[model samples]
Target: MRKIPKPTLIAKDVFLECISTVGNLLLKQNYEKCQDLVEAAAQDFDNKFPLLEIYQIPRNLTVLGSIGKEEMKSVYTYRMVKDGMPGNTFYNTLKNSAPYGKCPLCSVRFVETLDHYLPKSLYPILSVVPVNLIPSCSSCNTGKKISFPTNSIEQTFHPYYDDIQDESWIKATLLPYDPFGFNYFVECPDSWEQIKKDRANNHFSSFKLNTLFTAHANEEFRGAKDHMKTLFNLHPDELIKHLDGAFRSRRDQLGINSWQAVMYYCLLKDNWFVQGGVLTF
Candidate 1:
């Protein structure tokens, strides 16, 4: 949903920082032994990340010695996230990297944790990889997560890699029914490849952006109902003008596909809504 700068730190630096704080001698030695494989995997991740070729990298049962999936995952949970650990600095840095401190996935919720772009349970080698982690809200992080993308269309957008902010895709249509609310969707550019469009669509549905936006939009409309009624009573044109200005502001400040802008656009264009239809639910 939003593009964020990739972390300047690479895999080896973060790995070394974490391994330095480990008190277990044999475990530390084993982690050190795995460093070569970790760095190589990290390089493969960096190379294949943008292309959805990450599935090309191999997955194994363990990192090295007894450092299996959950153990590798704990390197993140204990060393990286736990307080006073040497690697906690990198953890906080990555967690704080969210743009304006908002979860890039939903853009509404404040970031609460760093989510593994690829689950650590499956890809243990990438458990501590920087690029594999994304700052996200608890809700977004817990929802149905990503797995291997067998093809281009199934791949979700990586905020650090994918930037769709330049174009408007998010759209809302007046339901004009008993609910009398708007439904959210995307209208991606025709110039984009079919696979690109599919990926955008997948990101929207996978994150449940439509449901999130609609719920918030209803709250906003309810709070602004009195103002809308007043504007409509004064003049229908005044209502449209207010919405027009609001849409422009939201579009300028947020991206054009932002729910607020599209919601305003939908309302302003609806004849029923402007001509005293503002009173309806």
Candidate 2:
């Protein structure tokens, strides 16, 4: 996963803007009695989010588009949290910050939308909190729909908080076949505590990262097969060197554990693979 820079927008500003828009809508809904409560709730939300203590925030407000009210057709109908306002600005900033505009959660798909790091449905107070929203591809967003961690240990790696890219953790293995099948997994370092490691594994499983990585790796292997054969034919002795160089290049461009880097490293380290074993596959 790619690391994401913290959003440039101020959380309090975004929260107040949302409160103003939603509060105006609430006023239109004849909920004048609740305005003071809404304002207080908004302030509370703004304060709590930056502390990374979202789990403690209460979900007591009954506003315009809360899930309990069938009158509100969609939770996102609340304009403050809706696209085209601060949400759009936040999304644009995140997308622009990403490497090649790819989703930070998977680093594969193009970022198409935002995922609520804390599901807005559960944490309605943070429905429009800038830091709670994450730029995501449709796949990761849809897959992560409504799932929130109950505690800090269960929390998935936040691209804004956790930077796994600095270290090598992702690993790949080639399966025996004519066109080899690849399996990808997160291999957490021993230095990490069990909770941290478990969370990493949970994040990988929750996002179906392995499945996505394997599909991409297979496509990459197919594309690289002919090139590997050509290179091996020209200079069999230099195949390992070429593969090592490729690994380093990809590692530098992406990260040490990027799929391409791990794949190249594995291929170079495998005696059979460097001798053009992949050619038979």
**What RMSD, rounded to one decimal, does every model reach?**
1.6, 4.0
Residue-level lDDT tens digits of model 2 in 1-281 = 88877765665455444334443565434433334444565556446544545556655434544323322213234444357754345546655776788888887789877787766665554555556677789899889622876665557777776788877778888886754688888798999878778878888888887788888888988888788888888888667778889999999998886778888887888888877685685
Q: Once superposed on the true structure, which residue ranges of model 2 sit more than 4 Å away at CA?
A: 19-87
Residues 1-281 of candidate 1 have per-residue lDDT tens digits of 87898888879889888889788898888888888788887888888978778666677768777779987888888989899999999989998998789899888889999888777888898888998889999988988445556566777888888888768878898776776566999789989888788888988988899999999887788788799888888988888899999999998887777788888988988888888778765
Which 10 consecutive positions of candidate 2 have the poorest summed lDDT?
66-75
- What local distance difference test score does each model get? 0.84, 0.68
